[model samples]
Target chain A: MTTTALKARKEFGKTLASDIAHRLRNEIVTCQLKPNESLKFDALRLSFGASFTTLREALTLLAAEGLVVAEEQRGYKVAPVTLEDLHDLTHARILIEVDLMRRSIEKGDDDWEIRVISSLHRLARIEERAPEDYASNTEWKAAHRQFHEALVSASGSPTLLAVRNSLFDRAERYRNLSAMFRPHPRDKAGEHRALMQAAIGRNADQACNLIASHIQTTSNNVAKYASGVISAG
Target chain B: MTTTALKARKEFGKTLASDIAHRLRNEIVTCQLKPNESLKFDALRLSFGASFTTLREALTLLAAEGLVVAEEQRGYKVAPVTLEDLHDLTHARILIEVDLMRRSIEKGDDDWEIRVISSLHRLARIEERAPEDYASNTEWKAAHRQFHEALVSASGSPTLLAVRNSLFDRAERYRNLSAMFRPHPRDKAGEHRALMQAAIGRNADQACNLIASHIQTTSNNVAKYASGVISAG
Candidate 1:
């Protein structure tokens, strides 16, 4: 084979591995694949229809993101969820995300305001359209992520935004896994509306407090609802 | 071959890839491998005595840490050092690292105080013994890292610490590559001593301010010294 062809083939292999990883990442983050579930080579090979090398590469990527746990010679498993982890993640997010939101409120221009409102509108639509399965609804998840991202879109720091993103994704898993049905769904629309109102009004203090409360409320629900699945300790 | 032997061989392959990556990281971070320099696979294979696959894996790991940049179909280059990057990294580090330091000052216990003193002592020793070559001195590098790490060791949040560590390493590159000769050397030992004093005094405000100033001072030195190598824009 020509050198160019060999390089192309190698690139193709990498892209394929990454593609498989993306699919697995989506499944794992949304709880389509349960936490602590064994990801045996045989079973995953059947499911992903990729070679062991490709599958292993994909798993390694997920492991780096803390979604999958690599067991030296044994293989991989979905990382287990526990309330303790949720509390720590929630606490960190509050510190970083609230600071980001405050900066966004202080510095956000008209374009930033527009994005906040647009994302909020989209999120509200998904909540109304897919209220029943909103927890596991992929569309809702994306819209929800967009709304929060837009809130901090003008944080003016890529580094802080990256940190916020990682914490958000880790928190997403716990939210999806727990509380399939909330006796009271915690007035998410009202909370989001208040958040938007405070942000656009340039009330940094209110926005920060509202976000801190919003994050903790969800965390509380996850703790109570996921008691069966996650240990409190 | 037995199944066990095959598994062992696979593990060994991974270990070799990671070992090469660690060696490359130390060299790159210490500026032995200059910034924006090409990382041709052939040269790396000859130098590291590793196969193409192992070297590629090693490069990929460094790429993830922003130590290496991958150019499609052209292989890789060490990530560039720029004044703009230094400014942004410095700003972000000030926000996160200062907050972490404040938390440590507020919450750090007796043991944390001991670590603070010990790390400061080590850092001072390196600055005195290796003053001439401290910038590229690997021992000084490790000592410097430990001192900063110890400052935020009681931040009570792993997430924030991880963010601080990444920003620290990225900034380390700029400082090493750009300021091999600081006209004033910035009195690093004095600054570190002040940070330790404020921290141990349980004075969060002073400690946070001191850290912020300490970071900006180094950035100022890098900016002026590296004017020749980096475009100001």
Candidate 2:
């Protein structure tokens, strides 16, 4: 084959591998794959209808993101969750998030402010439409993520934003698990509104403090539910 | 094969993959593998005497660590260094390290204190022996890492520590590059000694400020040298 043809084939292979990884990532985070379950290559090949090479590449990508664990002899497994890990994750998130928010408030322009307000409005609408509907929970979660991202979008440091994004994804997985096992009723909408207000008012200290408490409450709830789920299992 | 035998074989494969990853990580950070250089699998497989599968797994792990970039059709390449990225990295490190130091000071036990002193002593001795000996630079780098790790060992938060570790490794690469290109001399020993003294005195504010400045100075120097190197190349 000519060099151009070879290059094209390689590019296609990479895109396919990435697509597989993205699908698997979604499944793992949504708990469809279940934590700690070994990802047998043959089974994944059959399920995804991809070659071993493609599946292996996909798994490796997920492993890099900490969504999957590359077991020494056992191939890969969906990363397990625990109360301690959840607490630690939450703690780190609070630190990075609050710091980013403070920077965002200090440096964010009008565009950043508008995005935050719009995201909050969208999130509130989603929650109001179906706060407890499992069918629409995914939409609500997406909106929630957007709202949080918007609040800190003006940090202007890609490194901080990247760290915040990773932590947010990890927390999202636990949040999803929490909703699954224990459907607790809480004033999430009210809390987010207050967070938005504080951020918009340029009250960095108050906004950060509110975010800390906001994250802490969710973590406590998730931890309580996660433990119960583990014990029952 | 029986289940046990099959498991053993799988374990060996995983170990081989991990070993390859470790070897590549060292090379990338030390600039043995130049940045933006494509990691052609065929060549790597030949050089490492490993199969394509094993080599690919290794590259993916490095990619996950941000030391390597997995290109679409071109395969993997060592991540390129830029002054902007370096600055962002330093900023993130300052925030995390200082916060961690504050916590460490508040909670570090006597054992933690002893470890910090020991690490500092070892690092100081290494610097004094050969401040400019490129041959033993790796040893010096390891000592420097240990000293920093020891200072924050009492943070009591694994997540924060993990993030800090990743950022530290990234910065280490830039430092190595800076030394290779510029080879400037500085009072690194004095700075580290003062840092250790502040921590040992339980002066959180002073220690944190010192660390922030220490990191900033290195970053500034590295940036200046890195830009020159890049332009020269």
Name the lDDT value of residue B229 in candidate 2. Answer: 55
Looking at model 1 chain B, which ten-residue stretch has the lowest summed lDDT? B5-14
Give the alpha carbon lDDT tens digit for every residue of B113-152 in model 1. Answer: 9999999998888788867757667787788899999999
Reference-based lDDT, residue B148, model 2: 92
Name every residue pair that clashes in candidate 2: A73-B11
Poorest 10 consecutive residues by lDDT, candidate 2 chain B: B5-14
Residue A57 alpha-carbon offset, candidate 1, angstroms: 3.4
Please list the C-alpha lDDT of all candidates, in the order they appear.
Answer: 0.81, 0.83
Chain A TM-scores of all predicted models: 0.86, 0.88
Q: What is the per-residue lDDT of model 2 for residues A1-233, given as tens digits with 9 covering 90 to 100? A: 56796445334245777778878888998889988889998899888877988788888877766678887666889888877778778888998998999999999899999999999998878776776753227787788889999999998888789778878877888888877777565567878899899999999999999999999998898887777654232
- Is model 2 an incorrect, acceptable, medium or high docking prediction? medium
- Cα deviation in Å at residue A144, candidate 1? 0.8
Interface RMSD of each: 3.3, 2.2
